[model samples]
Every structure is written in structure tokens, then in C-alpha cells.
Target chain A: MTGIRRDFQKILLALLLGALLPASAWSKTVIGVMMPGNSAYFQEIHQAFLTTLTAKSSAGTTFEIIVQKPFPDPVALSNAARKLLAADPDLLVTYGTSATLAVLHEKSHAPVIYGGVYDQFTAQLAGPRATGCGFKIPLTSLLRHLRELKKVETLNVLYCSLEEDSVRQLNELSELAKEQQLTLNRINLKNREDLKKAPLAKGDAIFLTGSSVVAAMLDEILALAKNHQQPSVGIFPDRDEAGITIALYHDPLAQGRKIAEIAAQVLSGRAPGDIKPEALRNTELMFNLKEAKNIGVKIPFQLVAEASKVIK
Target chain B: MTTTPIANSRIICRVIVLLLLLLAVPPLAFAQTRELVIGIEPEHNIFTQMEEYGQLVKYITEKSGIPIRLTIMSRYGEVLQRFKAMHLDGAFLNSYTATLAIDELGMAPIASPVSLAGESVTRGIIFTRRDSNIRRIAEMRGKSIAFVDPATTEGYLFPLALLKKNGITDIKTFFSHHFFTGSHASAISAVLDGRADLGVAKELVYQRQVAKDPSIAAELVILEESPPTPETTLCLKQDLPADLKRKLIDIMLEMDQSREGMAVLKTLGLRGFTRADKADFNIVRQMAKEAGLPGRTSKRQ
Candidate 1:
């Protein structure tokens, strides 16, 4: 705790030094973006944010963006937040719930815009200088659809304890399992070693929670699941790329454009408190028909017909 | 008891008469022995649609005291073909097929399913992606369009009528390319993913897709929406008993009032059924007329 406090003090002094720059040095607006994990989803969002921010800006306006990608652990998250604060950007852009909280934990006066968090309502991720977009996917719907793909007596949930969104999903799945008359096998994958140490996966199916840690190890998990001959689902934009049987997730491009909208407003001298924080409820459900075929499972025709996208 | 010769002869005559009656009026005999078969074409998926139709058939049979059966048609385009070979008392037909049936076979629409939005009618939509440069019908020239099946009123008729009204009589000359998506959701998906520059589909389906994936709203923009026209309606053969049709319509329209009726509706994914009349399908008729669609004679011809 003392070490973190000392780091915070150093970051504050650096921010003070940044504030002392000349007017010419402040001609171009600098925005610091800190992402917990360098996941493809985050990268897509960051790219969209940049594209939209550029498109929505004035004819000649350009931003000097400083980005930090850290491994999403507690210490790394704090360190990433401190590094971004040292830059003392005009606004702080964060992806994911933990990254947002890390910036908030710093107690920085810099305005913050967050995106890609799940169920911001439950987390109350509101602050005086922070406003952005998040999403709420129906975890129960994911479970229901997964069961339709295969008769699930036992469901294996792969989540990371370090990610707040994944933990919330884990808890939600636990409740849903009771309602659906299903037994849950919770797998907390904090690191790569934890995944290696996981017991033999014998569940009827596997569910991939929206954790970067878990997403990073998706190929290994999917391989093991296929070896067990179990169908798998995910709560991200896996899009059949990693052989996830089903994916129900928010549209990252939508969230990216929305976050850019908020960030642009903050840069244009609008208070974050004035802009209302929004939670995007638009979720896309996709079925990877080829993946199901590989796992020797069949997705119901109704589910296939109802999906927004089907990869065959 | 001893049987008299007169009684024995009377029994023989009665048996011969019964056999002759069955042979002479085979249609009436079949009607007496068989349930009313109502054929349905796929709205999205045939399996789910059949299940919903099954619940509806069971409900109507119980309430109207008319034994009803449902038949899943091979394709939406095979309505008149199926009715010709099969003894169908009625069918749950979409606007285009119902209009064609009304013209060719004298089928009258009695009731239409109320969508989950509480509306018994739906509209046609012309849409394209938000990032696409095609907004006006003129801009769609030399660009591909994704259309639902030709048998669908909202999918094909609406756009056809719209183009004709704009003086583009020949689609082959105007459009660079076009294809049918076989389903409304697929048609919308085509435009959303940039597979097609423009798409025409049922407005209710577009709304449902947007509800499921709201990002669709963020990505696509509607260029035009047609006036509300009847959705799928329960059209019965004109030769059916008038009292039976009345009873079925009454039972269907009252489905939202009773718990048992509501349960059937829950399975059907519908709020309720609403009474429909010939005037409700004027827009479809107008579109067909504008599109210059030829009405084919019944296969019985």
C-alpha cells in the first residue's frame, strides 16, 4: 500500500510538471488511453475510437494519443494508470471495468471516458469527471443457447478472478445454473499456469467469460474442450475465429464510436458530469456452425435461424 | 327371434346405399373423416413455425370444436401447387400468397396474427448501411440489392412497386445485380455486413433484428418504409361452411382474453390474433398491380 501511495505521489508530481508546459507545447491535445490487455477486441475498439474521433473532430484537429497496454494484473494495472497519468493528458480513455477503476483509484483530476465494461449499472461506474459507454449481455440467454447446442448436465465456466466483468458474469452464471437445473464447474484462470493446472474438463459444455486473461488462453482451452468432445460458447466477439461454438457479445465498433463521441465532447470544453453515462444493451448472438460440427455437436435449427450471424 | 325376409332385404339395401354414397361424393366423405388441413409456409425457420402452428391448431380445435390439422409447405412459393394436390381447407398465408389465393382460388382472409408489437399489420422497408453512399432509390442504380423471397410481399412486391412508380420498369437494366436471401433476417444481415448495398425486407423483421442486435440500428439506415399492409392472415377456402369460419375467427380474436388462449399464443410468439377483412390488404393489391404481377390460374385448371 505504501509503495502504491509513493508511486501515486510521483505520478502527481509528474502531472504537475506536465501542467507547467508552454502554450506552444499545448497546441495539440494529448489523450492518454490505457487498456488492461492487448486483446483483439480492445485493439478494434481503439482503432474505431481513433477513426471516429478523427472524423468527428474539426477540419484540422488532430490528437497526440499515448497508449499503454498492461497484463491486467493488480500491480500492472496500477502501474499502467500511473504511466498514463504522468503524461497528464487532456482526457483519459480506458477500456474494461478494471482499467476504468484503476484510473479512478488514482484520484486524477483528468477527465476519463471508459468503454467495454459489462453491466455498468451494477458497478455504479459513475464519477464527477468520468462518463462513457458500456454494455450488458444477457448471460442467461447465453446459457440457454449453450444448452440448446448440447444437453448440459454440467457447465464449465472459464473466467478470471482479476476481471470485474468476468467475475460478475461468473456469479450471474451460477444463479442461472440453478434456474436451468444445471451444475456449474467454475474455473478461475488468473494466469497461464492456472489454466495448465486445471483439472480434466469433463463438463457437458464450456462457457468463455469476457476476460482478457481467459481470452488470451482461448486456443488452449478450446483444444482441451474439443479433446473432451464438449461444445463451447463465449461472451466475446470470438466470431468462430478461435472455434468458439457460440458467441454473444456487444458490438465493439459501436462502443468505440460511442466512447469517441464522449471523448470529443470532453475535449471540446464540456464537463463529464454534463454528459450522461450510457449502457449499450445491443448484443449480437452468433453461432459457429463449423465449430459445432467439428465438436460432433449440432446446433438447433431454430437457434441457427435466430442468430445475427452464423459461421458455416 | 326369427328374422323376416323383408327385414333382411332392407339391411342389404342400406349397406349398398352407404357404399354408393361413399363413391358418389368422395369429397364430402373425405371432409367427414378428415380434419381441416391448414398449410403454412416458413416465416423464418420451418421447425419453429410448425411448432407454433401446432399449438394454434390444437387451441382452435378445442375452442371452435372443429378438428384442425396443420401442414408445413415445402416452400413459400408452393402454396397454389400444394392446395391443388392436397385437400386444404385453409392456410396461414402471407400477404402476397393470400392475395394470389384470393384472386385465383377465392380464398378469404379471416384473421391475422398480431405481432409482439400488438400490430396486426406490417410494412416493407428499403435499407442500406449507414456508411454506404446509397440513400435514394436513384443512388441504388448499378448497386446490388438483397431481397427476401419473391413470394414475400414486404420483400419483393414493395420494392418492385416502388421502382415501377419511379419509372424503373426493368430491374435487370437498373440494378447491377440482385439476389434473394430466402429469409427476412438474412436479407437484413446482408445489408448490415455490406454483402449487399441495399436490402428490402419486412419492417417487423427489421425491427425484431434491431431489437435483438441494436447495433444494427447504429450501422444501417432505412431509405423508405411502405404503408402498413396485412401480415400473415388465416385465409379459408370460399367453399368452407360459413358458420365454421365465423366460429374460428371468433375463437382466434378472443385468444387474448382467456388464459388457455393466451398460453397458446405464448407458444406462437404472438400477442394475439386480430380480425381481418378484404380491405386490410389493399396495399398488397396495389403493389401487385403496380408491379404488373400476373395472377396464375389454380392448378385445378
Candidate 2:
């Protein structure tokens, strides 16, 4: 009877240890990150996420960060997402609207954290396991700065016709312009050549939307803006120097940290759905004084003083 | 006994929560230690160049409480690339690079170095050996010329536009050979060494070199000079926090007021830094357009 009781106790202890071992013994967490491109902004998000996760993991959870090669288009992004999903990562992090959509399309049960997206709601990325930061350039703020920069009777906007985010931003701007009683000229850019051929009237300020095509053709567009002497405003903070008179955009590092915080919450056993998608809280205004002068617009000293950076 | 088990379970839960809190705190604290990175284009021996700006870097860091790192890019193109990559938080850029950063990177100029003469404008000078007979711009046709990188506003674009205005429209046809020596000093050295009959460089650089070595003035004669344009600017990436930006600008603009700050400015060959306005670089953009060169050039040559 004594021998039997001792054997029974040993079996019960083994069962308890087996139940606890999976939680305590599992040392590594695998995270797969998909980025639209290997641009500096995306890299900042990636680095911040890894640094935050590694430093925060209290369980000494080692992480294997698998970064998919950057994809240029939606199709490439979808394909890369499929490959990353096949590896069965513990979590998925994506940068940009297109990349996040690609991961969502895969229907992977893994939690998805995204950053660098302009409008997550319009992108329709709010799935049960998806939540991250979105940078929606406040039109009111942009228009206010425009008013300060120039007395605008007409506001010209250039966007890529095919990009949903670009169109959405254009529509939003149109509504805002209507409320302000400002005339908005919407120019649809189909290709790089379209930017060069676009007719920009004098005394019209151009507004740049969050369009990949427009971002790619920024150089030509700025050159065109210079030639036409058109004062332009852009949503991309990074391209402030690219000839846009003003750029209102989010801080990439801050955005990265926000996404990392969400990732940490998910790692702490909170479902992604428990976290609401956050809009960019930190908006930076950059003034290109040189571009302003080239376009023949006078910036008020107050506006210049308010700028986060002034490129003179 | 049942109540005791429930209490023990609650204690276990509290311990677990405490452990989670402990783990999360350090990383969050570490993330707050932001780094301010500055990119300086490699114009000379990088070590010496860094040493020159070391005091300024220290002063900025001390004032802002943010650690600063200065990255010297190997070429002008690299400097633009780093800025575009958003790898740099701030930069000391030439007028052309500063203009491009404004247009392409949305970088804002905070301040610019003021010369001892109280002028922040620098002009381009086309020079040749005093003994050379290439007196007129047209006379140098089919002769070799050396210019600092094509990205330079004063050293290349402005002077190149001047050449074009003087009826040298086609460089290939007008000059037998042309190359970029990569730096103003190198371009002047090329002309002095007879490696190239004509060289273009910033007048400020030439003057500084002549001041250090008077023989350079005797050997090189100015063939033509371009109009005064904005000097090198200290720029910051637009995405930085507004408070940090203001602090940085204040520290830089007021650097001359303090002895330590003046010492740092002296090392950088400047009297002090003055607030830069956008109109300062209008001539640079105009010259770029007039030169028929793209406002932003990827190639250094």
C-alpha cells in the first residue's frame, strides 16, 4: 500500500509539472515584421519595436525577429505576408497600410501591430487581432498653416487616382476646403509623366496626399512646383526639403514607440482587440523658407516661429 | 481552510502582477533616453572635422540633456541619403544640400554660420594657376576643368550656370574634360598641381586656405566669381519635438554670447550662428534652375 501511494504521488507531481512547463520553459518568442519598404521611417519602427520588446520582456523571453524583405506593391506585400505566415510566428508587425492589409488578408490568428499607416479606418485594418497607430494629417491644422502662409482662394491637390488612401485624403480635403469656402483643384496623377504635365496655376497652393505614387514622384512634382512658382504643402514630414513650402506629419520614432507599446501589451497576454487604434498624437510642422521664397509666398514671423523646423 | 486557499491564490496573483510591472519599467525608462544624431558631409579628414565640432556637439548635448552623435558621411550624396533615410536628426549642410533637404526631406534650417565679417553668404570662384593663359571663360574651351562635387551650389552649379550664361552651353563640347575633385580644397589643389587647368570652388574655402597658407593665393588667380549665396546651414529634421527644436535653435543662435560657445564657433571657422530665413537660399534655387541641373542630384560627380 505504501509503495502504491508513493508511485501515485510521483505521477501527480509529474502531471502538474507538465502543465506548467509550457508556460515557464518556453524561452523564445518569434515575431515576424513586414515592411512596405526599407525606408528610414520603417526601419525606425522596426528598431524601436525590437528594442522595446527585448527590454520589456520580464520573463527573459528571447525574441527571434524575422523581417520579410520589403515589398513595393500590394501584391508583393500579400505574397510576402503569406510566406511570413507559413513560419507560424507568435506575433506579426507590419508597416504601412498596404503591408498591414496584406497580413490581414492572410487571416492569420496571430496578433497584428502596424505603424506608419495614414488612415487605418479607411484602410479597414481593424480586425479582431489588429490594432496600431495611424498618422492622419489633420486637415484643419494644414489649412490653418496654409492660411498663414498665403491668402488662398484656390487650393490644388495632387494625388494618385488608384490609391484608395490618396483618394480618401483628397475627398476629406475637399470637404474641409468646402467648409472653408476655398476652391480646391484636384489633379489625378496616373504616372510620373503626369506630374510633369500637370497644369498648376499661379497663386494656387498644392496639397500632397499620402499616395505612394505621389511620394515616388515627389522630386518631379517639386521641380514642377518650383517652375510654376506654386507654394505647396505636403503630408509627408520627411519631404519638407523636397520643395514643399510646408509639411505636416508625425514623428516616426514616436509612432514606433507607440506601436511597440501595443506589441508589449499583446505580449503581456492582452488581445489586440482590447487595444483601440490610436491616431498620431504628435504632429510636426516644417517650413521650407527657401521653397516659400521660390514660390513667392511670404511667411509670417509668427508662423515661422511656430514651425518645428524652418528650412531657410 | 477554503478561505485560506482563496487568500493564497490572491497573493499569487499580486506577486505575478508585481513581477510584470517590474519587467516593463526598465525598457520604458530606457526608451526615453533619446539620441540626437547629426550628419556632417565629409569635406576633409573626418576625424579632424569631427574634432572641430566636438565642442558644439558637447554644448548642445549638455544644454538639451539629449546625447548627440555626429555621423560624417563619406560623400555629399551619402549625406543626402542619410537625411532622406531619416537616420539623421540634424545636419550641417551646404546651401545646395540644405535646399534639397528642404524640398526633398522637409528639413528646416535652424541657423547658419556667420562669418567673421558678419556675412553668411558665400560665393563661388573659378580659378586657374596665375601662369595659365585661360583668361576668358570661352578661351578655356576644350581644356580640362575640375569642380567640387556637382551637388555643391557655389562650387559647381552656380559657377557652371555662369559658364553657360557666358555661351558655354555644352560642357562636353566646350571643355575637353571635366571631373569633380570631391571637395573645394581638392579642386583648388587640382588647379594648383596642373592636374586641371581650371577649377571651381567656394570663395570662402579658398580664402581660409589662403589665410592658412599664403602661397596658395600667389599660385591661383580668380578667373570669375559667382554671386553671393547662402552659406552652409545647420538644419534639423522636421519630425523632432518642438521644444527640442526650439532649445537647439536657442543654444545655437546664442552660442556666441558665451566664451565656451565662441571657442566652439572659432574652431568651426565662424563668428557665430544667426537665425536663417528661407529667403536666404532663393538665389541657390534660382541658380540650380538656371544651371539646368536637377534640384536634387543623386550622383556626386
Winner by lDDT: 1
Model 1, A134: alpha-carbon shift in Å?
A: 0.4
Which structure among the candidates has the greatest TM-score? 1
Candidate 1 lDDT over A72-184, as tens digits, reads 88899999999999988889999989998999899679999999888887777777888998877766567657766778898888899989989999998887777668888
lDDT of 1 at B181: 74
The DockQ-based CAPRI class assigned to model 2 is incorrect
DockQ (C-alpha based) per candidate is 0.07, 0.01
Off by over 4 Å in 2: A1-27, A37-40, A58-60, A68-73, A121-124, A201-203, B1-301
Q: How do the candidates score on chain B by TM-score?
A: 0.83, 0.85
| Backbone collisions counted per model | 0, 21
Give candidate 1's error at residue B60 in angstroms: 15
Cα lDDT computed for each candidate against the true fold: 0.82, 0.77
Candidate 1 local lDDT, residue A264: 86
RMSD of each: 13.7, 34.4
**A117 Cα displacement, candidate 2 (Å):** 2.9
